[model samples]
Target chain A: MTWHVVTGGAGFIGANLVRRLVQTGGRVVVVDDLSLGRREHLAGLADTLLLQLDAADAGALAAALRMVPDGPVEVWHLCANSDIQKGVTDPSVDLRATFLTTFAVLEVMRTRNWRRLHFASTSAVYGDHGTTAIHELTPTLPVSNYGAMKLASEAIIRAACETFLDSARVFRFPNVVGLPATHGAILDFTRRLIADPQRLAVLGNGMQQKAYLHVAELVDAMLFIRDHADGPHRIYNIGPEDAGIRISAIAEMVRSRVAPAAAIAYGTEARGWVGDVPRFRYDVSRLKALGWAPRLGSAQAVARAVDEIAQQEFCRYDA
Target chain B: MTWHVVTGGAGFIGANLVRRLVQTGGRVVVVDDLSLGRREHLAGLADTLLLQLDAADAGALAAALRMVPDGPVEVWHLCANSDIQKGVTDPSVDLRATFLTTFAVLEVMRTRNWRRLHFASTSAVYGDHGTTAIHELTPTLPVSNYGAMKLASEAIIRAACETFLDSARVFRFPNVVGLPATHGAILDFTRRLIADPQRLAVLGNGMQQKAYLHVAELVDAMLFIRDHADGPHRIYNIGPEDAGIRISAIAEMVRSRVAPAAAIAYGTEARGWVGDVPRFRYDVSRLKALGWAPRLGSAQAVARAVDEIAQQEFCRYDA
Candidate 1:
């Protein structure tokens, strides 16, 4: 039996991916600091070993790996400082959480001679490319510290794969959304409407648009690419084919689902925050060429995520 | 007067750049850890302030910046782990020295509101692109920790420029050779020949080819780009127009100059070391378009560097 190590595995996408891995009968080990990842997310998964430790600490990570049974290990390195605004406020947040975590993991892999690694990169690495469709070949000029660190991690991983690793896959994620949503537009809107049912204050002009992929579909594509990709190192953009949904549409969807009577107000700024990229288009043709694509489009993914978040937060959906 | 802060200013390229900055009458401050950078490199330069501290230490760097007189500042971030083999042996060497130094400098710049920056990037960021003439737009897939960290630094700088910096110029350097040499093929050859004086042992198959640029010309292009570049961020590959010089030819050049009777023996590997890129072609069209070019070709640069290294090493030229 192969050991599947998932960093940040107690978080949103990680938890979802963990469920899939468990269902596939893989012995899974989760490395999470629990700073952002909730242990309850993996509550029902009795077979998975949860190592509540910082992934950036190589010593802790090495100890965790030692606890696992000896076998071929595949690491799903999804660990990162997901909050872009926090990274903008404190660059070290991303530097340590995102970039250092990858570094530590790669170092461990090198020392142990363990090979396979699947990394969660971000579309933010493309920066504000405007409307230009970002393919795998897009010039990565990140605008945010979070994006910068993620790009840095990718570069390091690329180097490791070229030098030591047997193979590594880097998936540049679009905005991921689904059940057990920790933080994002849908969750933010849902919580706001829950607190003040009469008012919904949205960030930016609500014109910011971005592609979204449901967590389940994202997991499917990750596994598909893992089994199919046949190179020492590869990078693929994983996202829906649609252009994206505007922030305004997402706000309305959440408000309508949670509280239809809420009055929505928006900030005049074009972007949501200091490091926000208002718009981008992901040309996931590379992933598509491997005969894999997300099951839901951006709008449909957002719609499903809104309902899922409402149900997860409130235990029931009024709509 | 404008304050010019050069990290690693006591090293080869940095020392040369400091000499030029002093000649131009700029108030210069140098930050070096003195680990690889020799303090004597800046001897007799009475006007320059030297801060013997690690550039990766943000607090130390910030304190050093405060010591300088209040004025507009230009940070020439040249500090890095120059030894590729050492970085390959210990990844943290590059991570802390190369990547963190840039991060610390940018952070200090952001906090102090001092914007101008000139980063010493490397052609290693391009990795082993084979014979492809690497332009600024070429995909950067670095294969060495040194190269990876440099790429990471570039990404962080790019983000900083997009967010906080007034302007930044990233110059991708080819193999630089000149007087006051710290490390490189020519210096290695000279030192080895000096020690043995009979047989010269060459790393790699001696077929490894790469562009060489004299420190004088590199300093010239750096200042030229700083003065002429108009954008918030710009990247230029600084190298000679010719293809490059082979390792065998360089070995011959050094052998002929240092030990005329020495027999050269080459390693079987194509690359000098694990992280070494055996060959690369730098497309200097970007810098050329800016109306700047290196005065010496690769062969000429190697020849000049050979004589300079011999003089610096032996205090006289035998050739």
Candidate 2:
């Protein structure tokens, strides 16, 4: 039987991916530090082994892999420093969490002769391309340390594929939303409303806009790309076709669901934080070419995510 | 007085750059680990201080910068794992030497408020583009670990510039040749012929071709770019406008200068090594537009380098 190895597997998107993978009846090995990923996320999942360790530690990752029975192994490299703001504050965070994790995973794969790899990259790699539609071929001039490390990881992965790896797929994700939310605007807004339901203090001017994809749709596209992508190395920008919903719109969605009377206040700065690309447009034609499309648009995804997160966070109060 | 900080000042190109900086009457701080760089390379340079330490150590680098007297500082980051094959053997070599060094330098610069940085990037970052004339805007997809790390460094440097840096100039150098050669085809051929003058063993099939630039010309272009370039970040492909000279031709040039009687034996593989790009075309229009050009073509650079290296290596016989 094939083993699906998901780094950061118990985290938000990783957890969603793990849940899907488990349903497919494949034995899964989850490697996560659990800094943000909770053990409860994968509570009912069977045939799953949770290895709590830093994914960037090669020896630890290698040791974890050794415990798995020898078979066809595929790695879903979803582990990374999810907080872009933290990375801006300390560049080493992304260097270790994002870049080093990818390097360690690739090295381990090279040593063990494991081939298939699905990498979770980010749209930030394109940096601030303004309104220009960013495709897979867009020049990656990252503005943030988070994007820089992701681009670095992509470069190394490409090199590995060129030399030793059988194949690798790099999925450049836009803002991914939905379930088991660790950190993001949706989660942050929801938490803030829960703490102080009278006012929703939004970062930036609330005009910042970018594509969004639900975690379920993201997982589906990933699995679709893996099944369909036929190349040594492939890059796909996975996001909705629309330009995206604004932060103000997302703020309204969260505010209405969490606290209808909450006054929305926005920061004067156009960007939320340092190294934040306020706006971007993703041209995911390559992924669309493979006959895969998101069921929900950016607004729909945001709306659905807000509902999911509000319920999840509010449930704690009811308990 | 303005100070020039060269991270790899004891190495080949760094030494040459240091000499030029010294001639301009600026104080120079030479930071090198001396693993591959030699102290003798920067011999007799005036107003220069040598700090022997790995460039990747952020604390050490920060401490070294503190020792230098306060002044207008410019960093020429040239230190990296020069041996592509070594990096292919062990990826961490380039990770620490190339990528981490850039990160460390950027962090130190950010802390010290040192704004200006002239980075020594590589054609390797362009990877195996085949015969496509690579421009500064070329989508970089590096095929080797050396290239991967360089590309990674470039990404981080770009991010730094976007965030805290005043300005940065990234010079993507081709095969740099000429005096005090540490490693390359010319140096390798010269040493091999000196050991066994009967037969010259080549790594790859003789047809592999790529642009070459003399260290003198490379240094000249770097200074030229520093004086001319503006904005937060700039990248220039520094090389001859011509496609390049073949490796077979380089072999012949080396053999003629080092050992005229030596028979050349070629390996079947087109690439010189595992990570070798083998062939590439550089469109140096970007550098040329700035009114800078190499004094030597690919063949001329190779020939001149062969003569210089041969003389340097063969001087012991005359003594």
Q: Output the number of the DockQ-best candidate.
A: 2
The residue-by-residue lDDT of candidate 1 on A196-284, one tens digit each, is: 99999988999999999999899999999988999799999999998999999999999899999999999999999988999978999
TM-score per candidate, chains pooled: 0.97, 0.98
Model 1 Cα lDDT, one tens digit per residue, B182-212: 9988998998999898999888899999999
Alpha carbon deviation, residue A269, candidate 1 (Å):
1.7
Over B1-319, each residue of candidate 2 has an lDDT whose tens digit, in order, gives 7898899999999999999999989899999999989999888888998999998999999987898766569999999999888888889999999889999999999888888899999998877888889998788889888899998998988888767788889999999999898888889888999999999999989999989998899999999999998888999999998999999999898888878999999999988877788888999988888899887899888888888888898885678
- Per-model C-alpha lDDT, please? 0.90, 0.91
Give me candidate 1's TM-score against the actual structure: 0.97
Which regions of candidate 1 are displaced past 4 Å?
A: A316-319, B316-319
lDDT of 2 at B260: 92
